[model samples]
Every structure is written in C-alpha cells, then in structure tokens.
Target chain A: MTNLTSLTIRQALDGLKKKDFTATELTEAHIKASEAARHLNCYITETFDHARKQAKESDARYASGRAGLLDGVPIAMKDLYCTEGIQTTAASKILEGFKPPYESTVSGNMFRDGAVMLGKANLDEFAMGSSNTTSAYGNVINPWRSEAEPDKQLVPGGSSGGSAAAVAARIAMGATGTDTGGSIRQPAAFCGITGIKPTYGRCSRFGIIAFASSLDQAGPFARTVEDCALLLQSMAGYDPKDSTSVDRPVPEYFKAVGQSVKGLKVGVPKEYRVEGANPEILALWDKGVAMMKDAGAEIVDVSLPHTKYALQTYYVIAPAECSSNLARYDGVRFGLRENTDNGNLNDMYEATRNAGFGKEVKRRILIGTYVLSAGYYDAYYNKARRVRKLIWQDFINAYQKCDVLLTPTAPTPAFAIGENTADPVTMYLNDIFTIPASMAGMPGMSLPVGLSADGLPLGLQLLGKPFEEETVFKAAGALEKAANFTALPQSLMDKAA
Target chain B: MSIDINTVRKVAKLARIRTTDADAEVLSGELNNILSMIEQLNEVKTDGVEPMTSVIEMNLPARADEVTDGDMPDKILSCAPEKAAGFFVVPKVVE
Candidate 1:
C-alpha cells in the first residue's frame, strides 16, 4: 500500500469508511511522517499520545455508526488557538509556558467533529511577521526550496507558516491557520498547499490569541480544495461567545467544491499587477486566468483602485487594533510575569513585556501605540480606518462586475530565511497580494497552480464577496482541476532523514 | 513625520514595554521606517468616509446583559501567576 500520509482528508475518510485502513493506522502513519519531518520545525508541541487517544475514540465512534464530519482526520492546530490543559503559545516567549483553562471555539468545533490534533503548529510570534522568522521557537522551514539553493533554509511564509508546511510535508491531512494580512494564503502558496481565510466573522474568534481583532479570522490549510472545504465546514459556525462571529447559516461547503463555474464571472484586477513583481509570477497568473477562462469562467477586467493603499491602511489599522487587543498581556492575569520580586505594577509590566516579547512584536506594539496615541489618532488611525472603508468599497464595486477575483497569491515565491528580515517593510510586502482581500472581509483562497522559475510552487488566489466562500471554493476547484498540480516536495523527507 | 528616539521611548512607555536607550535608538529607526511607509495613506483623500468599526455588516449583537456563567474561581485563578483566596494578586495599588 502507498503512504497513508499522502492521502487527502477526503480519501482518508473514505478509506476509513471502507475499512481499507483503520483510524489508528492512519494516525500512526502521520505520526511516523511527522517524526520524519521534525527538521521543518512545524510544531511547537506534538500531541502524539493525545492524538492516539483521539484516534481510538474516533474508531469507537466508527464502530458505533456515529462518525462526525471530519472523523479520524489527523490535523495540525495553529498554536494561537487555546486548548484546555495544553500549552497554547503563539510562538512567543511571553506565552512560553501558559496553558489555557478553556478551549478555543474553533478547535473545540473541529475536535467535536472528530478531528484528531497532531500538535500545535508554530507561527510568527503573536502572528506578527510575514516570513515566520519572528517565531521564538524558530522559523518553520519551507518544505520546498529554490532549485538553485536547496541547502539554504527557506521560510515558510507566515504567520501561519507551520500549518502550511505541515500540510505540504504530508505530516497532517489538513491544518488550521489564522489570516490577518495573508497569514494563511501566503504561507499556503509558499508551502504548495491550499489555504483559505474565510470572510471576517465566518469563524468565531473566542479564545484564539488576538493579533489584530478586526483583521484576524481563522481558516484551514489542506493539500486539496476539497479537503479545505471539509475542514472549514467543521471549523466555521456562529458562536455566541464571539460578538463579531456572523450569525449566518453554515453552508455545507463540500457540496460547493465541485460546483459548476460555467459562465461564472472571474475578475482580473489591474492594480494587483504591482510593478517590479517577478515576470514568472505574472506569467503563471496569466496561466491561471487562461485556465479559468478555458473552464468556461467569464474573465472580466475589473478595477480595485484602492488596492495600492491597502498595505499602508492595514499597517495602521492592524497595529492599532493589535495594540489595544494585546494590552491584556501585562504581567498579570495569565502568561509570563517578570520582576515579581517586589517590583511595582508599572515596572513589572514594562519589564515583563520588554523581556517577553520578540523584536517584531515590540515594534508592532510601539507602532500601534504611536498611531493610536493622542494627537496622532486622527492623523494615522482614523485616516487608515477611512481608507480601510475605501478598500472595502473597492471590493464592493469590483464584485458588482464579477463573482470572484483572481490573482497571484504572492508577488514572488518563498525566499531564504534571512533574505527580507533586515527591513520590516520588505517583509510586509509579501502580503500585498493577499492583504487587500483580508481588509475587505472577503473570503479568499490560494491553490497551487504552477511552479516558479526557481522550481518552487506558485499559487493563484480567488477572492469572493463576504460570506461567499462557496463561490471561492467553486472557482478554486475549477482552477485546481485545470492546473492538475500533483508535484510533491520530494527532497523534504530526504533532508529530514 | 518620522519618530525619533525620544518618541520611541515615549511610545514604549505608553505601551508599558520597557526599552533600554540602545534598543530605543534601534527601534526609532525601525519605527520611523514603518511609520514613513504608513504615511502613504495620506495620499488618499478620505474627506467624508467614515472610519470603519467592524467589517461584518451587523448590528452589535444584543443579548440580555446578565451574567451567563461564573463561580469557578479555581479555574479562573489557575492561569493567574499570583493568586490567593479566590483573588488575583496584583501589586499594591493603594500603597
């Protein structure tokens, strides 16, 4: 038999149903694969024993004819989500040893639906940086490397880098990721997988470690668009605990995966053709457009003029919200505390934060504080919010002309770990293609369409209107069928060994 | 307008994150770079646009403002670094 790890979630669930493989067998195969791929640094904490227990329970459910939607699926949980009794670090020293007393609504939903967690995946500390290099545990290695520099370590695009890497390496069938400014889609593109950031309010934010409250939304990473559909079906729903969670009915997304895209309007926004982007990436995007057109999707030229201001607007708004949201992490209720030995409250907060947070997080907190500070609030924060509304309006106007927008997931392929870390703005540019959709609260997805000149995977993005993930899934599925991308990161296991 | 080292220190203080003079100097340059890049938003004219509060077009969910669940002091304090007698211990605020 071939590798159980290589099978998609849909395939594995079918195999389990047919008795072709036991849940235990599937889980063990992935555990072995995870052990083999430890060099990727994909996980902050591996829950192998817990996974075995969950698989056993899943097998019991199968025997009892009470299987859930994602029965026996081995998946990676991004560490930002709190798991009761398990240390849920957002890959930061501040959250180093803190374990939540309750579960995040998203993970609880998945677990309730019979998904077995392999571990908490690593991410950018507090989900701050784009390259995954800001993680305190270590930068997650992209399973795919540039053909010219296989020995040079490459970053799995972040802040959802570890989840993307795990799915790409076949260590997990699917994984959860949070996208605030392309955290999921960019990393998925970098790691050669499919990831979606559902529209804002699609997934509840309860107990998920906050980054930028308004921008942050949880989604799934998988090898195939169908698998993402399956995982997202379980992960998304209205939760009373999260006020921002949309109270809309959860559609059976699996039904939408292979739904017809015949005559569907697919928008090609002109502004996304950022100057100085790689010619190869642009070429591949053209190929994606061609593939969709061939699949009978109506290709329409659309305008999203506010796109150029999106990154700057996101920089201001995200940090402003992040500053407000992260204010709870003082040396107080939970997480790390420094200078506890008779230090004043203010001193302890200052010391613990300075000692606990990494450079990037501190940089953001400072930036957020500055923008939201007195005299600067109207200048930076309010202006950015107004521009954010403009970005949203741009999507609204474009959606009038099309059902979904198509573009390159990232401007370029994955780069070496240290390549963009010297300057913060350069790292921020990685999200330019993915962030606009995030800002507008539209559902966006990335699916591998082609390889770059350097032989790394390049993905094409599909953005749908708010709560229109079903449309995004249909477009992505049509494109996926046309691209037929089946290439694996063949040498990743060899390096792991 | 780019930030200087003093602005960095002031922001750090406002953020309650202690920074040494050396770190502040370095952070000043990084913050200046980030802030300068963010300054591009000034180019866009947002004369009458309202600041966005939430992306989801929904009214603030109104529930009866009443206590839902409480009384597990042990569970709540379990995460507290310093706690005693069902109370979270903090530095002497009144001292």
Candidate 2:
C-alpha cells in the first residue's frame, strides 16, 4: 500500500485492469490519504461520494471490458475549474458559494475519459500570487517539510500551490493546474513534484475562471513525469466552444516519454543567470546539464536577451487582460454580490467589488485599469506588447539552435511564506525563469533535480517550441529517470503513515 | 511617473474597489515606486515597433454565427446573489 501511493497513473490503471486492485480499493486508499494529509490544507473541498460513485462506475466498465486508459485514476481539480454543481471559488472571497451551470471543458473531458475527481484543490486567490498565502481561505502549507522544522515553513509556491501540495502529499495521484506566468511550474518546483503547462490553447479554457486569458493555460501536476504526460494526454484537445482553442489534433503524449534524448539540442540561456539567482540554483543547472550530457543530449549556449523584460511585460499584459476578464464578476453577474441602494448603479458596482475582492486582487485590478486607461494605454500596455514580441522572437531564435531550452525553475527554492509577500515587486521576481516561455506561448515543464543546501527541493525547467510538448516531456522524463529525486519530506511521509 | 493620492484613489474607484484615505496615500507611494521600476522600459529603443497582443502570432479562429451554449438560466442564476424571473437582478439605473 505504501508503494502503491507512489505508483504512477498508468501503473495504477494497469493494476486495476489486471484486477490486482479494485477501483473502489484504490479510491479508498487515495481518499484516506487525502483525509490524513488534511493538515497540509491542500484541499478546499472533498468529493468522497462523487469519487466513490465514479470509481464504482469505472469498476463496472472494467467488468464490461470498456475501461479507458485512465479508467480508475483519481485526480484533483484546481478550485478554479467549474465542476457543474460543485462550488468553484477560485480561492477568492468574491466567488464564495458560487457554482457553475456548466462544467469546464477540461474537467468534463477528464470525467469523460474515466478519471475520478477527488476534489477541488486550493489555490492563490484568482491565481494571482506566487505563494499560496494569497488564498482567502488561508495559506496552504508545504507538505514537503515537518512541523518541527519551523523555519522551513516555506510556501508550496503560488496559485497552483494546493494542486502541487496535494500531489506531493499523495492526496491524489495527479491534479489539474493552470499556469499564467509560473503558477504551475513554480509551485511544482516548490513542492518537489512534476508539473507541465502545455502550449497555449492545447486545453480549452471555456469554463476555467479567467485570470489572464492570453497567458492562462491548464495542465497537469503529478509525482512523476510519466504521470504528468498521461494526464496531459486526456486533457489536451480542441473545443469549438473556446474560439482561441487550437484545432490541432491531440497526440499520444506518453509515447514520447522514456524516448532517447540522443542528439537532442538543449539550449542554456545566458540571460537566466541573473544577479540575484542563488548560487546553489546555478549549480543545479550545471548538474542538470551533466545529467543530460550523460544521457547523450548536447548542451548549447543560447541567448534569450529579452528575457530580462519578461516579468515587466507579463505584469502589464496579464493585469491588463485580467482587468478586462474579471469585469464579468461584477456583483450583478453570477458570483458574490453585496446589496446596495436600489437607485445608484455605480454604488452597487463599487460596494459589491469592494466588499467581495481581496486586497491583492484589488491592487491588481487597479494596476490593470491604470495601464489600460486611455492616455497610459500607449505608454504601458502597448509598449509592453511591443516588448512581448521581442521576447517571443528571442525564443524563436534560441529554438533554431536547440530543440529545448533549460534553466532553473526559480531563482531559489521555496522561501518563507511571508518573506516576500509584503513587497509585491520582490514576489514578482520569482517568476523570472518561467515567465519567458509563457510569454511566447511555448510549452514548459519543471522536474525536481536535487535539494538546496537548506535541504529544500530544487527544480530544472525545460521549454519547447509551440505544440512540441513531446520534446519537453522526453527531456523531462530523461532527467527525472536519471536524477531519481525521491526526497519526500519526512513530514508528508509521517502524515501518510 | 509619480502617481499622487488623488490619482490612486481615482484608479481604485475605476477598478470598483473601495479605498480609505490612508490606503490611497500608501498606494500613491507604492504605485509611484512600481511606475518608476517600469520606467526602465523607456531606456530601450523600440522605434517603429508594432505592439504585440498575444504571444502566439497565429490568427484566432472565428466562431460561426451559431448559438451553441445551453440555456440553463436557473442553473446560472443559482449562484447569483439576486435573481428574478431567470435574469440577474441589479439596481435600476436609467430614467
């Protein structure tokens, strides 16, 4: 049973297919694990009954010889995804008690593929913060460390923090995560797990709560590279409901895993070696290069000179788009609303938003509005857009020399929760490595490498060209196999027991 | 590039967020600091550059003139704070 907790989705499904374990038994193990890991605060809601019913159906399907690849797999959905009648809060006060009429395309797709939904995972409010502290419900503690290590209460990385923590804690075999800037990869790195943000438009965003439409993308978080690939295979597809969704055919993602990395051109961007990056992080990058070289990959020096501008451009572009996308959340619509005087329209809007949104959310909305405001639009938003083009072009140029780009996922491992929260600017700096690929709409993945000197997990990031997720997965799969990073924090192990 | 308290207040109002006088004062300073940091963009020469909208350069697919969404007014309004006759209710504004 202990080893079963570490099994990948494919492994678990194979067990179910062979009747080595019933879907009900597997679901109960995951549910019990999730219940035991409650101290980590990874879940906002649990769907035990729903999970049981789904597992039973999967068992019935197996009995009927209709089992799918993920027939009996239990997965978690980030709270941001609408689950029909299930309350989708986006971890914000504004959307409290809100349930959607329709299910998000991704969640629906997962359910259709016979994936069992464990529950809604916690997240940064509206997927805004790098640390999970921004969640209105409260901060999700990193499950990787023990309570005795008081000083090491480092965050499980933001926005997707809950999803990452859930997987790391064995609360679920895998979970869905959305990445705008570094939400998916950074949190995955912080929690010492694997997360992939597929190319933009790979997954439909039809019913996922909007943060930054252009940058927001849904992906998967799991314990292993192979698990992440298997989850992505089911999640990636075209939906005409989402106009921006690509009409491209979904590929068999797992086929690329464990593929040879021989002759693979890996680009190491010089610009990512910024001044403030931790020395250990840079060392890990070298370690990753050596590991890849041992596996027959060729590491080449490439320049993404415009990488320095990614954070600034992302802040402007994301908030500007968020300001527009969040406009739909005004009290009169489908979420939380505060009552106002019957005659005053503006006051109603003001009271509802003011009472509903959190401080960070408000700050972003204000910043977004200021950038998109008439006179400043050209100076801030438009100028940021122009710089965005240069950033994308830089990636294009690098890919010409390399099949994939590798860099440190974050400048450092998870910092103390409140360390950088007070200063938003400092917190934004955390996204430096992951934001560039997002700016170019390329697929990116984070795989655990080794531990920092402080004994926290470190992660290496890989970037691939648009729609070339297989290359990213192959490279990540190779490194994951070679690195063999199995350092589950004693805290999580103790809780599992 | 410095923003004043009044400007911060106005921005907050436009964003539909309530702000106290002290918050506006603090935000004015913080906003100014952020804008100053953003000022670094001014140093780069972007002559004749067309503004980028999305990271991907492809044209967005256009939907045909067809309505495909399910009409579940009751389900949609189930989460609304105020609803009436299958429509979301808001304060009356126009004369």
Winner by TM-score: 1
* Candidate 2 local distance difference test against the native: 0.87
Tens digits of per-residue lDDT, candidate 2, A338-373, equal 776565777778877888888778777888999999
What does TM-score give for chain A of every model?
0.98, 0.98
Q: Which stretches of candidate 2 lie over 4 Å from their true place?
A: A1-3, A146-152, A341-343, A495-497
lDDT of candidate 1 over A1-497, digit per residue (tens): 76798899999999989889888899999999899889899999999999999999999999898999999999999999999999999999988889899999999999999999999999999999888999999989988877887798888999999999999998999999999999999999999999999999999999999999999999999999999999999999999999999888999998998878999999999999988889999999999999999999999999999999999999998998898988999878888888757658998999889889999899888999999999999999999999999999999999999999999999888999899877899889999999999888899999999988778999999999999899999999999999999877856556547
Q: After superposing candidate 1, which stretches have Cα over 4 Å from the reference?
A: A340-342, A492-497
All candidates: CA RMSD in angstroms?
Answer: 1.3, 1.7
Note the Cα lDDT for every prediction shown.
Answer: 0.92, 0.87
For candidate 2, the share of real interface contacts preserved is 0.65
What TM-score would chain B of candidate 1 score versus the native chain B?
A: 0.92
TM-score versus the correct structure, for each prediction: 0.98, 0.97
